[model samples]
Target chain A: MQQNNIAIKVNGLSKNFDISESGKGFSGKLKALFHRKRKIITAVDGIDFEIKRGEFVGYVGENGAGKSTTIKMLTGILVPTSGSAEVNGIIPFKERKKNAAKIGVVFGQRTQLWWDLPVRESFDLLRVIFRVSQSDFNSQMKKLDQVLDLNSLMSMPVRKLSLGQRMRCDIAASLVHNPPVLFLDEPTIGLDVLAKESIRNFLAEINREEGTTIILTTHDMNDIEHLCKRLIILEDGKIVYDGETELLKQKFVHEKVLEVEFHDDGNVIQGIPGVTVIREQGCKKWLTFDNDNYGIGEVIGTIASRYKIKDISVNEPSVESIIRNIYNNRVTLAMPSEKSPTK
Target chain B: MESIKIYIMLFTTSIKARMEYKVSFLFYIFAILSFYAGQFGLLFILLNRFHEIKGWSMGEMVFLYSLQAFAFGFTNLIFSQLVNFDKMIVDGEFDRVLVRPLSPLGQVIFSKFEVSTAAHLIIGFTALYFGSRYANIEWTFYKIILFPVIIMGGVMIAGGIRLMVTAVAFWTLRNRSLVHTVIFSSKEFINYPINIYNVGMQFFLTFIFPIAFINFYPAHFFLDRSGSGLLHPSLEMGTPIVGIIVITVSIFSWKAGVNHYQSTGS
Candidate 1:
């Protein structure tokens, strides 16, 4: 994609909060009321990246890692402390109204629909708020109905719907305006497997068919793995990793484990040229090696030639384990500089 | 114009929603009307015993009380959302407002449409008509024309105080009780004539928050009474202007408050 076609751009974007430190209990609260001890917290610490048009990017981080803060700033709901950001060529905070007309946002924990009003009434109200044309509104509703199964949900009050159903309606509500850019903050946080898959499929269809640039923040590993082609991982308010989802697994997940069992209990396995005999039991031996340097086929072939192997199995690392490794190790991986592709 | 239509649409839907609980809705109106009527009855009994207060008759007192109620009811009806704005901020709903194409203040103003407060208007107009029969003040073109304007001025002043008080929530994140005190306490003081209070309070009510100009000053000017002398008597004539200024300043404060806002977390 051309650089000029970037839909979302961030240049050293940051947000700092002045949090007040309070004491414990009612008396402590009174003391705090009299004398507030304030401290500054850097919620988003100067992160930078660009998302191309039609790109499905999963913005993932643990709780309090500034994922929601970044989405808020990009959508003009919160102003950054320093630096700048633009969505579709408009500075979000400075041109909030104009930017609002061009984007849609949905928070998983909240509902934009009026609680007491029926679902159809809420949609009709949004139609006026967005000033959507009559024909456009009908067409969009029909399209949403097909995927969201909104026909059965049109008359139910929002407060009456289950979590999965509400989330579907909320997603549909955000798209009533047909904004080119969409922000989904934990859109599938509390959904069931089938509900999650349905939302994921709908999001993919929207991105592919209408070319909507989607920025999804989610804690569901399945959501990130299934929906997003690109991934941005934030830790402690900093962008620690930004690359293709598959490339992250490939780069960090270097070693694979091999387990083998022998029929002869007396047989002992020795170290091979490229493999380490990490463990041994009565009839089983475990070996670990770099899959890139020594192929699993070669290691198995060597083991079979040397010992009478009864059974063999290879354990490939998953993306979940790779992320857990990154978190536990806290290794500052070398990030690709701007304008350079990681591949 | 489009914003006004949206406001009407929202108002209709809110009324419809409130009407869903039919028994509670009617009971609310009945209960509130009775409460205000009981309070008025107590005041009437006190006035009957005193016969007149500071040369002001019971009918004149009724005029003042009911006119203020009219203004209060209208302001409370139209700007009810401002009263609950602090709760909206704490609940993270304000961020949703910011994501919409509509102006936040406009949305807040029309977010709710209250029907119960209309009871105040029922009492107000009835009191005005009844008090006119007994007070026997000669009607003039000016008095007839300026009555509604002064009532509108009263509405603006009430709304302005609400806006200013609630705007403090942008920074403090909680101002419901403070707003309640500012609005209800002012209503309490304005129940009697401004001239009944001392100089300091009279000045505070007239110029500081300007609640007096909404009803008392305008009533004083129309009643042709020289109030217990604290300032130039002609200040009463400027209630309309004071109302406009109050609303304009409130809007500016509201704008500054919006800019000062840091939305709560999701």
Candidate 2:
């Protein structure tokens, strides 16, 4: 029964937080000491998804869309109020230590390393904690050092390293035990372009070579487009979009922008059938056309007949715009009702 | 075995981290020494004036005081990380511990083991040595064996108390006042014989909170004044047993808190 392939399976998982309404000012705080208003905030509302082993899934959502709440549940840090979550076929919350042994987690906001010790020493401590054999630890370290370029950072105290260096070391540390599943939450949050690329490459390499299941959550659209083949978008604690990344681009309200340079007076060009002129420069006009309705050759022909010959370039919708479109129209999109929403 | 290895590794690594700031580490030692010296000075002044507190002599008082200090100092060295555990919960940093393949409580205890308690140990040992010499108490071989057992038991009791208080934060989220009064401020009450306080207060300290077992009750066995304290003369032997019971109850309390957190997470 293909049970072993399911790295993570979540069913009807929900978490509701009770936020006490405390009033402002001294008297309000004093009054709150006696009694405070309580409101229940549903963080994750009955989400269901099954991620197969070796799947690279991007868990994208707006702030407060329950990305972290869901991650905590899957990581066994938070018990979902209702429903169940199984990691590697074991209920995570019921068996945190066992689950932890099989999963590696990285939080970009925090470092799990010992702050004052050398980075290399922290890895050894982790080795001891996870009960990895000496040979396995060495082999893992060799692989990590090669991918992460951790040679220079290993000897330095963790606090002395730059954020980027520390992050790379963090990722490498998490993978030391060779966990079958890795969860990364904004692993490239504050890193520069090169650092982010390095991390992305490392992640991609690890997923490919080791067949590690990765569940990544990030605000960075590049992380999604470049690394993740599958994307799961959450809106207001509900699954708004979940499927192939390419399919997401194709299905969303994404339009192709054609930038045309005029050989003659481009200002004279006025109308085109079913095309919106989004931007107009002195000699260039940027027109957006629905890719589904119009082919690029057809659009170019329409513009070619109307205007003088010119150089033209067509632009596909960027991943950022596609994700933005999803978030903007998430509520209006046909919501996933009480049924399996795993596309 | 794995837990012990991990604990030692964590403890040593943290100590190594502390050594990185040599001047700061020395300052910690100096500060603790000065602070304990002042506490002992206060005790010295009070005992000099009163001479005897409810039939217990000055040397006897110092023995009790040192015992309390010893128990607290050792326990604090190990469990000082637990002092601000409420803050850890409030800041949502405890999630890091939860995700680890170890007991959250054990991780907290081992990873943050404090080195600043060395000065307290020095002060406690010095006071105990002098107190025993001055009091001229006959030391037996079995008495020597029971000495460490009594201290370890007392430490367990204090550690249990700390664990319970810190675990309370899982519900309240912010209860520094309770932690402060119950853990730190209450240490002053056990500096002298518990019998000096009113019988009601003595009973409360003995039965309800049990800070008396840490030193006052156990000290009676050494001071040859077992029957005079309160309740039962044989209660002096109850330190280790009471420790096991208290720690068991507190561990249960800690588990309950973790369950509550799992159900209603921060």
Candidate 3:
């Protein structure tokens, strides 16, 4: 029943919670004793997807978007209300202990290390918990040290370490057991740019070198841009988009700003087929165009051939704004053209 | 067997962590021992002033108090996490336990081993040492052999109560007040002989919660006194069985509570 290439298979997985609806004040409380109100909230709607082995996929959603709930079900921290999921050919909730041995999880908000003990002691304890052989534990530590630079940090108590330092140690702690699959929930959240870059690079290297399957959920667009080649975007407890990470940027983030400064004020250029003048002050005009439909160079060539010589520059819209736009619009990006980017 | 080894390892780590704060640990032991001593002094004064209650002397009352204290202390030392399960649930540590490659119940129970409560044993045995002399209890083979079994059974009963209280947290995530009320009320009721209470109250403690079997009814059987005929004194033979039954029911409730558990906010 186990498939070799499928690292994860999620079929119509869902989770629902029953929350009590209680009234405020003493009279309301007394009156409600006879009739208790309750409401059911579907945190994770029926969603389906499969991840292949050695795939580094980014799962992105806003707060209260059911990202954490889905991870909890996959990690066996919470049982699903309906449907089913398998990680590495094992039903995670049914065979939690066995599945736990094959997966590594890192929660950015909390460290897995023992609070009062030194970092080395925490790893030693985990070695016993996971039953890692002594040689394997040493080799794993060596490998983690290469990327994480954990040698200097191993002696310090976890509570005394800085957040970034503790995060690095936490990531290393999760990998000591050499689990085949890793789940990271906001792994780079609340870290400085430098720290975030290092973590991203380390994750990329692990995925490339070790062939470990990683499922990451993060709100940071930079993390998705740098590390994730594929993405699954969730909204309102359902998958809104699932495709190559670059496709999202190309389709939704294709708008580029072209600012043209003409040599003479008399020369007023008319619009091209795909270019629209968004702002004009004096001889300078800022035109916006979809790069996917019409090449930036083609539009600039048409303007230059018609008018006097001018200086021009193009600016691609930041990925942050494009993602924000998509989230606000709640529309899947429909590629209007099949042509690739033209210089 | 592997789980037992891991439990010891976890307990050792807990002890090492507590040892990091040596002064506080020692002070806690001293404070608890002194607190028990103060309670003993207060009860000594009460029994001396009243002379006797229901034909039971001060020594018999001391024996009852000390026996329950020892059992409660032993259970509290090993299984205190069950009493404090609300905090773990509220802080989201229970989720961490589930992700580990071990039984959640084993990890939670053994995660917190309170070496500080060793003072309870010292106080209990000290009380017994002094109380047995005053009560003029005869040393015999049967009495000596059964003493350990009775103490262990009483401990299981205390642990069972703690487990039952912890199970309530699955529905009410932070029921600190409710848990403390149940634990403290039952502890208060067990310090005195069941004969002092009325018949209905006796039945309530015996059948409803079975707090009476922890020490009171056993004391009646050991002291060679005929109970009020409501329940037979020979029922003391089933103290171990009562402890076993109570623990089994508590475990079932705990499992059901775990199944019903919905983890808190992310």
DockQ of each: 0.66, 0.56, 0.71
* Pairs that collide, model 3: none
Residue-level lDDT for A29 in candidate 3: 87
lDDT digits (tens) for residues A1-343 of candidate 2: 7999899999999988878878799999889878988889999999999999999999999998999889999998887889999999889888989999999999888898988889989998999999999999998889888888898888999999999999999999888889999999889999999999999999999999999999999999999999999999998899977899987666664468899898765366566766888887778888898666667789899888877866999887777887786677752456423332122
TM-score of chain B of each: 0.92, 0.92, 0.91
Count of steric clashes across candidates, in order: 0, 0, 0
Model 1: iRMSD?
A: 1.5
When sorted by lDDT, best at the front, the candidate numbers are: 2, 1, 3
By DockQ, the candidates rank as 3, 1, 2
- Distance from true location, Cα of B92 in model 1, Å: 1.1
Residue A106 shift from truth in candidate 3, angstroms: 0.5
What is the TM-score (0 to 1) of candidate 2? 0.92
lDDT by residue for model 1 (B1-266), tens: 98889878877887877777799889978887788788668556644765577677777877777778789989988888888899989999899888988788888888786666767677787777756666666679999898889989899999998899999998789998999899777798887777777889888987897898777877776677775535577777777789899999999998888766777764
In candidate 3, chain A reaches a TM of 0.87
What tens digits encode model 3's per-residue C-alpha lDDT throughout A1-343?
3488999999999999888767799888877666778899998999899999899999988887899999989988888999889999999888889989999999888788889888988899889888898999999999999899999999898899988999999899889888889999999989999899889989999999999999999989889888988999888788887888887767666578988898877765565788788888888888898777777678888988888756888876666667787788843455434565554
Q: List runs of model 1 lying over 4 Å from the truth.
A: A1-4, A257-288, A303-316, A335-343, B21-27, B227-229
Question: Model 2: runs farther than 4 Å from truth?
Answer: A263-270, A335-343, B90-92, B133-136, B140-142, B226-230, B260-266
Report the poorest 10 consecutive residues by lDDT, candidate 1 chain B: B42-51
Model 3: per-residue Cα lDDT over B129-196, one tens digit each: 76677787776789889988888888888888888888999988988888788876678887767778
